[model samples]
Structure formats: structure tokens, C-alpha cells
Target: MSEKKGSLSINSENIFPIIKKWLYSDHDIFFRELVSNGCDAITKLKKLEMMGEAEIADDEEFKIQILANPKEKTLTFIDNGLGMTADEVDEYINQIAFSGAEAFLEQYKDKTSEDQIIGHFGLGFYSAFMVADRVTIETLSYKKDAKAVLWDCEDGMDFTMSDSDKADRGTKITLYLNDDSVEFANIFKAKEILDKYCSFMPVEIFVSDPSAEPEYQTIMEEELTDKDTVIEHIVEPAKTEEKEKEDGTKETVEVEPEKKKVKILKRPVSISDTTPLWTKHPNECTEEEYREFYHKVFLDYKEPLFWIHLNMDYPFNLKGILYFPKINTEYESIEGTIKLYNNQVFIADNIKEVIPEFLMLLKGVIDCPDLPLNVSRSALQNDGFVKKISDYITKKVADKLSGMCKTDKEEYEKYWDDISPFIKFGCLKDTKFCEKMSDYVLFKNLDDKYLTFKECLEENKDKHENTIFYTNDPVQQSQYVNMFKAEGIDAVVLKDAIDQPFISQLEQKNENVKFVRIDADLNDSFTEEISEDELKDATEKLTETFKKALNRDQLDVKVQKIKDEKVSSMITVSEESRRMQDMMKMYGMSGMDPAMFGGSGETLVLNANNALVKYILANPEGENTDIMCKQLYDLAVISHTPLNPESMTAFIERSNKILEILSEK
Candidate 1:
């Protein structure tokens, strides 16, 4: 190799400093950049071979080898790819922001099919300065007349070029670590970086460490234990060892000796599956293969319920696999791992704005070659294309859900409870998604069956018209659920916290449909109206007694003839007011208890048909009447919510005293 000195064609000397200081948020990204360059180099060579410009052996394997030396504090990426000659190195290495891949693609567009040539800005090589004091590249071009070249650059645009006899037709990049970034030179750290960024790369990557022990592979072979010992029997199952039968009749073969097996160990480490499941045809992939790939990627032991394999080339080139993980609880830690990739190079997992907020609750991998990336390939650039990608992801998820609900409803119903929270969250956040999912939205009724919004209305039309009664807490509202079930009214279960806002969205979507909580208002409370004389004679006295007994002016008590004579009374709270109280509780609004919303306690309904109300009405003012009214009010409060410690103790003592009197009789 001949040697020379030169400067990279950057306008200013501050470019390298800018790249090191502000381009990348994390220093470890420098390793990813360099490895990506190595992959690009290999991809370029393959393209050249495809164009018939160079000869490739039939069995030539394409791979990248990572070599690290802790003593030297150097990390090297060696690839058997297309290399560069002296002039080529001088032009590309001594240039800034000049893309060689772009030029090569332009030159060969008419001759060869396209490949995923990653380096578009050509500044990926300079990222080494972020962690290294110096960088060197040794390359030999695929050109027959090209000479091997050596290029060296310090922490600036100034670099040195030389000629050498590197026989390999590829490039080797070695970075000499700086004092501040020596951690990268560690063997384990280097391997970890490779695994994160290059594990699913299109090229096989092998890490070489001289200090590492040999890795082994175990192989088992069956063999005969002893031929002459008159053992039970052994046969070569691989190549059927048969014995002749003395009898004339056709007979099956018999084994000659007992069988034994030997184990053999072999060692070779290539730490990548270059061809991942996402890169293959959806029809070619089996369910097992998809699950195994998902297990390998996320390390989540729980099997995914279903997956959406997105392979689209039309509007943009996007390939990904989105898995609907088994989310057991609504409040379970929902940290979705969506690994984003640019040309199969790891970008970042937390690209929130690019991925819809709802889809952020899923685990998956997305590789978009055409995604506009910053210099570090970590931050995504804002553009219409990015917005399109986000919308497309939302569309794909909606489509998958729609397909599931239509094709396999029995199986889909099983996942509705687990997946409904995510869908409801999406609807609350995205209007388009809400519109798309309206038909596919499945609501479970009291009969343990699922139905659509229209179906719910149609099925319950005779009992409740245009009104959808739902329960937030199945346990707390089970009493009301039973009451409604007796009247042939099926209430949908809206158990998730997100359902707080989702009901409003559903109502707005269908103005004719009105959603009501089962505990919101009793049906009989509005069914009957009292005459003027009845209010003066019995209802007014009843209301006054309830007000006096509860000892709270905020309690608004109403008299109604409830349907169930077995019930003493029931409590009903306004749905709008309750939702407001729930929202205030979430924010921890100062000095606000959910029990006392809008400076008022729960609305107490006095059942006119109950026997206890008639006795309380007969003696509305006496101390015994007061005690009975207090107990009745307390019982209603207990059913609706928990009573205070003091109130509960008093109630228990009074109940025991009454029980002791009943035992005396």
C-alpha cells in the first residue's frame, strides 16, 4: 500500500466536534453506526455480483466478524464485502456527507436489482470519533486493477491515505478507543452492542475473542453395544439392518444387538439469524416459527395470543410483526417493547409519537428502510411520511381486529376481555380508530355472550329501548345486575378505568344510544309520580324523617315505589356527577372525597312498597323511629360504599342488642 495525507472535504473543521458532541445522545450508538457501515459494504458487494460486474463463488458465505482487543483498546469490524481502492478511499473517506451508496445505486440502476444499501449520508463512518481517538480502515476493492488502500483519521476531518496489499476483497474497520470510552473496548460490552444492533442484520455476524473458551455442540448417535454378547438387540435405524428369516413365510426384520449412542460436540459461534421471520412470506411462516421468533425478540415467556404480520410495499416499504401479548390485568405494568429498525439496524424502542399511543401497548419489530433518520438514526424526522406510517399502523391493527371478530368469533370472544382494554384505550385516543372499531367492538352481556352495539340494542329492545346499562364493578354492582337480569335487561360490563371516558365516545358516535350505569338510577324512581295530597300525607313526612335520621342536609332523599318488595331501599347516583367525581379522584383534587361529590352525599331512594317504610312513617318523629331510619340509611350506604369505622361499630352493636331482644322473645 502506498501512503499519503489529506483532509476530508468538510466545509468547516467543527463538523467532527458537532457529531461527537450533539449528533448522538448516547455514545454507544457509535458502534451501531460503524457496524451498519460494514453491513452496507457487504450489501454493496452482493449487488455488484448481481450485476455481473464481479464473480462470486457458489458457496461463498457473507458474514461480518467482530474482533476486539482489550489490551490495545481497539474494536474491529471485518466483512468479506466490496472494498475500496486507493482513489475510491481518497474520495469517499476524505469526504463528509457524501454518499457513495447513492452514487453507486444511481450508476447501476439500469443494470442491477436494488438491495438495502444502508449508508445514504456517508457520515456513519465518522461516528467512530464519538468513542475513539483514532480510526483506521484497510480495504481492497473488487476492481481487478484496484490496489489495496489504508485510511486513518484522528478526531478531526484531517486524515491519512495509503496503499497496502490487503488481499481480501472487503473492508476492515478498527477503532482505537479513547480514554473516556474505554468501556466499549470490553469484550462483553462489545458483544452486547453487536447483539442489540446486529442480531437480525441481513449479514451473519460472528464475534472473535481469543480469550474465549471453545463452545460445543452435542450430537447423539445410536450404535450397537456389543455384537457377540447375545444382547436384546440393536439395529441401524438410519439404514435398516435386516436379518434373513429361516421360515419361508414373509417376515419382518429383527435387531441383532443392544443399542448405544455416542455424543459428539462441535463449536462455531455466529451470533445472528440473518434471515428473520419478518423478512419471509407470511404463508411460508408457521405458527411455531412466529412464536419462536417472538420469544427470541422480546424474551417474554408468556405466549402471544395473536400476531399481525405487516408486509406492505405500496405507499412505503414497511415490514413488521405486531404481537398481541397476554395482558392479564388492566393495571398490569404495560411497558410495550416496540423495537424500531432502519434498514434492519436498531434505532430505538421508545418512538412514541411515530407509533400511535395505543399501539405503544404492543410488542413488535418494525423495519422501515425509507424512514428519515437523524445522523444517529435514533431520532425520527417529522414529515408526512412518518404520519402516514403512524396512521397505517393504526389501520392495520383495526383491520386485524375486524378480521378476527368476523372469521373466528368463538376464539375472538375468548380474547375480548383481555384485548378490549387496549381497543377501548385506542378509541378514546383516536377518532379514526373509534370509527373503524365501532362495528368490531364487542360488548359482553349478562348472559355471558358477546354482541355488537346494534345487536345489543336489537336483543334488548323489548325490555330496555335505546338504553345501554353497564356496570363498572361486577362485584360491587352484582346486586343491581341481578335486579336487571330479573327484568330481562342485560347490562354490559365496563370494568376498565379507560371505560370511564369510552362511554362518552360511544354515545357521541351514536346519538340515539344512551348509556346508563346500573347503579345510576332505579327504573321505578322515574316511573311513578305522586299526587299533591299523597306528597303532603305520606311522602313529605317520609322525606323529613330520612333527612332527620341521616343527620346530613346534603342527602337528597326521594320516595319511589320500587319493583322488588324484598329490598328495603336502593341508592342511585347521577352518572354525569359520578364520572366527574371519578375524574377528580384520579387527579387528587384537594379536599375532595368521592363519597361527597358536588357538596352532596348519594341520593337515597325510599321504597314505598317496603314494610319497614310503613312502620317508620307511622312514628316518623319518635327515638325508635329515628333508630330504625338510621339503620335503614346505613344499610343503603353500606351497599353503595363502605361505612366509616365508627359508623360500622355502632351498627354492629345495635344489631347485637336487637338480636338479644329477639332471642328473649
Candidate 2:
């Protein structure tokens, strides 16, 4: 144990052990803390020069060098940056909560990194005690006639500082590795740690070389004249044939030869890339550069479908690159792979909170210094800055998509299939994002051409009375689509599962704009001049017959008459009811409540001009009337519009039996 000196306190003895044992998981982080302290020293020197307190040295190269030796089981960190005086070291190291780095930074706030201080807390320097059994620091201050000081600490809170006859402009920390932490003294392991955690540091970091050279050369063996190399070759003799046995059988045998073996040469592996693409500016980065970075980070051979570069300063500082990977299948294999990085060091496996839920489909690097990192750099705390960064990233993505849509429609549509899910999810979950995304989102028409909501509405304004008609299931509702086509009104295909709720919310936000299903009656005019009394009368009479024909006990039905004359008897469900069913399904509720289903019943409109419905109304006992009624009702049910499947099947069977009787005649 070493003796405690001036300003040494007993409080550190109790807390320092707890910090070493529980504060961090890896003992190697001590190197990072020590290196950070070295950078802080360099920053302090630069600050003094900027403040006119010291003369600035020309051609000074600021760097931190790390040395490790496996044979000796020792590691050393040296910096040509700055040094500390005896009094400064006592105040910073001997006393807890008195941070020399923080004080230096505050005193030189006017200087930048080239002339500004770096570190804020002195606790980082003490981290060396976690891995080293004995740690020593030799430093020489920049002040004129300053004496060199040496500080030594063993496995306790006590430390000793004394005058040294060393000549240096900065500090050097030598650590004697403990038996359990011998790996830290390995050159290869130390290099890996520095590359992963300190690759993009402001100051250049140097570590021992861990690679060896391979060469091919001619062989020499005593000029081929040694006694062991005598020029005499021996040959094996031939074997004789076997003799006949007493059983009157002759046999011959041969010996097996030994196999020859070939040797293969092994190559060395290098794990670090000094330059990562994210550190470069967006303009300087080519598409190939981005792709290479993606492959390096994710190890995926396939190229990204699209990318968004994020660079923002205020409201908050944030920087990153997000990529949308191609989703070739429905297996959801490419979700939640986006990595979160702080100062180029990986912080988390998946950045769910930093990026919107919708953007989880993207895979790339998000490096934000503003993000709060725990000691291990494994998790991030949720704070105001994190939220601000998330919002900024979302905006950047939206801006990229919108810009692509405006510049090149064809290219935008090509990538839309891959990015649509992310966009839809963003709109559904984030209200602010939804408002910004509405203008750029697109819909695919029956012809497979992409159309924006505003564009579709504008083109069909005169024909549809400003109503946007769409269908959820195109295959099941082919009849409705044909009806809309015959009336010359274009309807969008809302095939995505999220479309129903998204549109419902969109309708509520906008006025005079309606999203009607294709199966909805076209004649239910959006135009003026149809009296309310006339609509009420038509609805009452039709509702009465529809109830009787469709069997109101098992099915709920309503009727409404509209203006356009294309076809008859179309079934349409209310947007509210559809939204509720979707919500119930999302929550995994198999048994739904009747009251919660909403009172919006399905409306079945009959075209008064259609010959089948006209014949049924004129002669309620007509033979073909029942068959036509059952077929129409079944069609409505299959179209996902609403009809009782059981009652419709029974009506169909009875109609079939009646047809059989007519055939017998």
C-alpha cells in the first residue's frame, strides 16, 4: 500500500472500489479514459496559447501513442499534448469532485479544439486502476522553469508524487497489467480496442503494429554439401509372390503405400478501417461510397434501395446516414437492423427510439454526439436531445422522398414499393410526420400508374364531384370496379392494411373531400338540388323491402338513392365501421362487441332502372325475382361490403330448388 499525501481524503477509499467494480463492465475502458485525458491535456495547452498566457509552438503534432507488450505484460499511453504541474495534479487527482479538466475547459471557453480545452472531469484518469496493478504518470508542464513530476499509485486510494528529472512536454502513463487483465497487454487486442472505440477521435491515436510480412526466397542448406545431405539415394526392393497353401489355393498380396500431404499458408487479418464513409460530407460521398460503407457496416452483399443523409445543427446537433434495404419478400427479414453510433462507436443494436418506428426498415449508421451514453456505451437515455434528433431524422427522410418525387417520378415509383411500408407506418404513428408526408405519398391506380392524393383528386374533380373513390380488395370487388369504370370514374386501389385508418383520419382533417368505396352508390349525388324529403322517402321505401328480402334478423341493411345511373344494387360499408373492425383485429380481439362495431350499417342501393330489381318491385311473386335477389346479396357479401352469409346461402339453395322444378316442367 502507498502512503496518502497532501489533500488526500478518506472518502475516496469507500467509493472508488464501487466505481471500479460496478460502474463499467469491461476493464479495458480504462485505456479509453486515459486516452481521453491525454486529449484533454493537449486541449488545455492550446487554450493557454489562445489566451496569450503561453507561447504557441510551431509544427507541433498533437497525438496520443499507445504501447503494449505481451512478453512483459505491460501497457503504456504517451501523449505529446499537455502536462500537469504538481499542485494541479494534487487538486485534480487527490480530491474527488474537483475536476481539473472541467476547470481548464471553463477557463478557456473562447478557444476551439485547435485552441480549446477538451475534457471536463478528472475521474477518467483514475480508470487505469481498474486494469493495472501499478500505474505511474510522468509529466512536464509548459510553464517556464517548471519541474518534472512523477505520480505513482498501486491497488489503493493512496498515491505519491515527487520531483523527476525527465524532459518531456506532455504526460506518459505506464500501467503494469494485472494477471487477470493480461489480454490488455496483447498488441492485437489493444489495436482492436483502439480501432473500434477511438477510430474517429479528434486526435490521432497510435497503437503497436500487429501484422507480419510474408516473403518467398530460395532455400540454402550448407551449400548442399553437409553430411546429412550426402548425394546417395536408396530404393525399396520388390516383394515376392505368396506360395500355395495346404488347402490347394494360391494367393498374392501387395502392401499399401503412404499418403503424401500438402501444406497451406495462412494470412493475417486486419479489423480496422481508419476512414469510415460517414465522416465525409454528403456531396463528397458517391453512391458507390455509400454502398461500400453499408456493406462494411452490415456485411450484406445486396445494395441498399435508397438512402437519406442527415446533417442538422440546431434545434439540435445530429448526423447520420439511413438506408432502405430492398424487401424482396414478406418475411420481414430486414427490420430493426439500423445501428446507433456515438462519435462513430456503436452504442446500441437497434435505434428504435432515435429513429421513428416506421423507419426501422432502414439499416445504417446514426452518429449523434448529443445522445447521452452510459459508461459502457451500450444504451442511450431518453432525453430532450434524443427526441430532437429523432424529429430531425424524420424530417430529413421526408425531405429526401419528396425531393425524389419532384425530380424524377419514374425513379421515385420504382423505389416506392420498397419504401411504402415505412412511409405508411410513419404517417399512422406520427401526427407531425403525417402532415409533412401527405403531399408526397402516392397511390397506384388500376393501370399501375402512381398518383398523389392531390393529383388524383384534381384530375377527377369534375367527374366525381371532388370525391375520391377507392377499393380495399380489388379482386373480391371486381364487380364494383366494373361499375365505376362504366360510369367513367377512376378509383384508387387501397390494398395496404393501414390504408383504411389512414384515410379515415385524413378525411377528418380535410373538408369537402370524401373517400368513398367503389361499391358505394354512384347516384348518391354530392351535387346540390336533390331535396332532403325526396331522399328520405326513397330510403324508407327501399329500406323496408331490403330488410324483408335480406332477412333483417341476421343482417343489418340501409338504403340510399344517388344521381349517377350506371348499374344497380351496390353494397358499401361505412368508413367508421371498417376502421373499428381493423382496430379490433390489430389488438388481437377475436370476439368483438356489437355496440363497439358502431351503428353504421351496410347500405345496399338498387338502381331503379335495372330490369331485374324493377321486375321484383312490380311483381313481388315473379319466379326469377328470388334468384336475382339471392345472387345480388351473395355478391355483396363476397365483396366485403356486408351481408349475412348464412341467410344468403339459404336463399341461394331455395332458388336452385325452384329452378329444378321449372326444368322438370
Candidate 3:
């Protein structure tokens, strides 16, 4: 046949501008598009063979090969599946065979594009123009006597087709990489793009580069076992008389019908695991296999604390394994790798709709064949299926955690430390997850014991009254922790930064629950009996002396007779007021006094039963008394917060003078 050429039929004269303008910024996508086209051709042929419409030669293996050469700056995708003829190319390119072209243009007419279905539309084959100056297609149709054809398109508009000697059934697309996209011609880059886009494609894909080690194709295999039909020949003694009629009944003949045996065939290497663990029944999988799969998917050396296997076909086809990894980086974003796939083909990583924002901290794989993707296939379209899938995932994770906590006490406690942040974050973000995981959420106390909110409430209901005492800083608030221990009460530790927001969330979730930081206030149990009327005069006198000595405008003072005389005094703050002040400071709001932090804008409780307070009451107006008042206030301030340089110097001077006086006596 003679060569023919003409402008491409489209709404616009050139498709490159459309692809370049609103399509994307990633230039390497062309490789994925072209490779996907090759896979599609293979798929069409496989479907034909399965339906008995065509016969694939046993010797002809269905495979996709990538040949990249940097020296020539050209990349070629070769497939041995199905090819095309010149007439077919013209028909396909004109927008009849490739259905996605018109739809894609319409979809992207306004919306910015994504990575999904870049190749789904017939335009995926044309994406080559984004990186290549010229692209050539040398293919031989699968017809018994179809001729080979060569089609060339340079400007992405005009193309020519002619006869060629490209002997093979499938297509071979060759891209002459432009100077700007020469990186795509690099062997490593080509291999990487194939690995990213075609890894899970349902075909045997091999990356072939001349520079490859030993000039071999890079082939990887994922095992998915199934029984194959094997033809078997059997021989047995026949039911003699009827079968041997022609041989005159004397001699018995053997007759047996051939039967097909279900045999397991040797699996070949492929780019992806066609059947992932999520695709199987949970009963069919074991703990060790799940752990190994987790390692392969996440590449994390640590075994996950637990995993939730999700498989549902009803509301929507949803299957995945969500793992609760052992989180150690409290300061870092708890962003986990949740790879989303559609029919085993990877779409994107950690898609928000499929994997909720809170579940992003989990490492897992979700493959939903019926997932709805908009024109670009970039993100999941908001639909009922998406909502159902997300709700199912959240429920599955909660069920797994709650089950483990109830069935395995030792294991639950063992993993509580590593998984607490994840559960807490999930509870804070998702109301339903919070509701389900509430019973399993745990906090560690000063006694090195883990307890849930229900357990905490049960133990402290009589005295603390649903108030959970927690310490944000164990070492800094060691004194307070010791007092709580002395009172035989356990104070939970909330040292991690996430623990702060988590505490607030816990309080918000339950009306009766309150998480009070150890230093946030003085519990009512720690307050001693007070004689307000009898000690009013002395309390006022002491409050006045400390105000003058500390040079403060106002001093909210109190006198309490406590049992533990070792603790001379402590500055107390209302939990509500302190939390408000912390909230204001955290937001960097100014105009608040720095000195207020020492007092938390609250009161200072003086232990009137202590020897020091007794001595101060007796010698309320002397110079010694003045120095002692300053020393006591300074001690409380230092314990409340680190002192300023000026305050520390004055406190030291006052202490030295008092020591000298005592020594002289």
C-alpha cells in the first residue's frame, strides 16, 4: 500500500497544547501512557483468547518489553500480544476505538487533571508527543494473514502509514525523545517509570535495556496460585459385552474416556501481584503471611502491632489490609503509606477519600475494583461507594483493635505505647472511630500500668470523680507525681506532644471525663482543712508580707493545714484558667504578662501547719521574716517554672544571708 498522511481529526488543530496546558507538570508521564497502551493491547488479546474468539500460540508468551537507549535518545515499548493494521490505526486514532479522548477533553475542559487514566482515553497513546519529537508505531495485526504497518506522527497532528517488515503480532511504539525529555531515554529512568505505572498490570512485563546487567530483562514475579485444567488419558477394563460387539464377545477390550485434571502450573514472573492478600478470605491467611506481606508493602523492619483484613463485596467491592504500625516518631507527621489501587493497578498513594485523613497514619493497601474515578482518574469522585468504603475501613480497624484488647490482654498492653498516638489521633479526627475505639484507648500511669478511660473512671470514681490526673512532664512534675502516689492515686503520663490534643479530645468526647495535668492544679484531695474565720487575720498579714517581698501587684493567698508537712507550699491554678492561658500562648498572642506564668494567674497556697509558716506568723514584721517570705515565694516560683536570671540571683543572695544568720546564732 502507498503511504498516506493528513491532519488529526479533533476540535483543535493541535493536542499538545491541551495536554501541556492543563494536563500536568510531570513530563515523565508519557512513558506510563505509552506502556499502558501496550498493556491494553495485551489485555484485549487475552480477552479474545479466553472467549475462544482467537487462539494464542502456546510458544508465543504474552509479554511487554521496554528497550531504552540513551545514546540514541529513543525509548521503545515492544509487546507480543496484539498488534494493529494501518486501517485499524486510522480508525483507532480518529477517536472510534479510543473512547477516552473526547470524554477526557470534556472532563478537563475546566478541571485540573490527575494521574489516573492518563492513558485510558485514546489520548494516552498520544501523550508521547509531550516528551518525544516524533513517535512511530510498527505493528502487525493478529489476523491470520494481516500485513505489517508503520505509522509515524511528528507534529501530533499529521501522520503517515505504510507497509513494513515488522514481523510480530503485537505493537511496538518507538519514541524519539526530545532534548527536554531525554531523561526518559535513560535506562534507569525508563525502568523506574515502568515499575511505578505498570507494576500491577495483568500481563508479563519486562524492562529490557542494552545497559542492563548481562543484557537481560528485569523480571519480577508475584505468586498467586490457582489450579489449571490438565488433560489426562486413562485406561481401564471396559464393560465388556457392549463395547466388544465388533470383536465378537470373546476378547475383552479396555476403554476409558479422557478426563481433564486440575493441575497447578508453574507461575511466571510478572510486574505485580494479581491476587493480593486482601483478595483472599481472612481464614485463608495466617498471621505470619500477613506480617510478611506488611513488610513487603511498607518495607518497614518492625512488625505491625496488628492488622485489619477487610474484604467486602456487598455495599461496594472493597478489599484491603490496614496495619497499625508501631509509631515512634511523635514529633513527625504520622503519615503512613496507604496505597490505593483499582483492580490491582496502582492509582495513587494515600488518597484521602479512600483512606480517611486519620487513617493516613496506618500502613496498608486498599483495592476497590468498582471505585469511581473522575475523568482524570486522579482522585476518587465523591459518591456513595466512596463513603461506604471509608466507613467500612474505619469500622474494620476499630473492630480489630477492640477485639485484640478484649481477647488478648497481655498483647494489648504490649502495643498500647506504640499505638496510642495513632488511636488517639484517629479518635480525634473521626467521631465514629472515636466511638468504637474509645473502649480500647489506653493511658499509662506513673505506676507503669496501662488503663483505659473506663478503667480509670472505675478506679478513681470515688475520690477523683471522673477527673483523670495526667502529667505532661514526668521529670519536671516529679514532685507532684510523688504526692499523687503518696495519696495512693495513679496519675497518667501525657508526655508526647500529641497527648496534649488527645487529652482535650478525650475531655470533649465524654461530658464527665476531665484530663487535668498534674501541675495544672491542686486536687481537692490534697487540700487540707482550713480555718477561714480564725486564720483570716494571719493569712492577710502573710499575703501582704509576701506581696511586698515579691514586689507583686496582687497575690491570691491561702492557708491550708495539710498532712504532708514536707511540702512547705505550692502555687495553685484553676485548670480552666491555666488551659486558657496555655491556649492563648500557644497561638502566640501577645500582651499577656510573662510573670503571670509563674502564678498561672491563680493563687498561692501556704501550708500554715508547717514550722516555717508558724515562725513567719510569730515574727511577721522583722527583717528575718521579710527575707524568709521572699525565699518561700521564690522557691514556689522556681518549682512552678524556671526563674529569670535576675530572680535567680536575688534568691541566691537572700538564701546566703539567711544561712549566715542561722550560722551566727
- Candidate with the greatest TM-score versus the true structure: 1
| Candidates' C-alpha lDDT | 0.77, 0.67, 0.75
Query: After superposition on all CA atoms, how large is the RMSD of candidate 2?
Result: 11.3
Better structure of 1 and 2 per lDDT: 1
On lDDT, the candidate that comes out on top is: 1
lDDT digits (tens) for residues 1-665 of candidate 3: 88887767666546677776656456676766666677778888888989987779786666788888887888888987678877788878645225655665555555554544444454557667788888898999887788998988886677788898987688888999888888887877877776776666666676655554442221112222232322322233334333446557755454554333332333334555556688889999999999999987778998888888888888788888888887667455667999887766777788887787888988988888888774235666656778888888888888888998899978889988888778888888899998888778887889888887888777677788888888876876676778888888778887666787887877776888887777666655776767678579778888888888778877888777766787777776667777767777788854686455542476777877789988887877876888888888877766666778998999889889999999999
lDDT of 2 by residue, 216-272 (tens): 222232233222323333333446567687899998755443333222222222233
Which residue pairs clash within candidate 1?
1-163, 1-164, 2-163, 3-162, 233-257, 234-257
Q: What number of backbone clashes does candidate 1 have, counting pairs of residues 3 or more apart or in separate chains?
A: 6
Runs with alpha carbons beyond 4 Å of true place in candidate 2? 1-13, 17-89, 100-120, 126-156, 160-196, 202-274, 310-319, 333-399, 423-438, 476-479, 497-501, 519-553, 557-572, 597-665
CA lDDT, candidate 1, residue 288 = 97
TM-score, per-candidate, Cα-based:
0.84, 0.62, 0.82
Q: Candidate 3 has which clashing residue pairs, if any?
A: 116-377
Query: Which is better, 2 or 3, measured by TM-score?
Result: 3
User: Compared with the true structure, what per-residue lDDT tens digits does model 1 show for residues 101-170?
Assistant: 3453344334322222323466777788888888999998888888888888886667888777688788
What is the C-alpha RMSD, rounded to one decimal, of candidate 3? Answer: 12.0
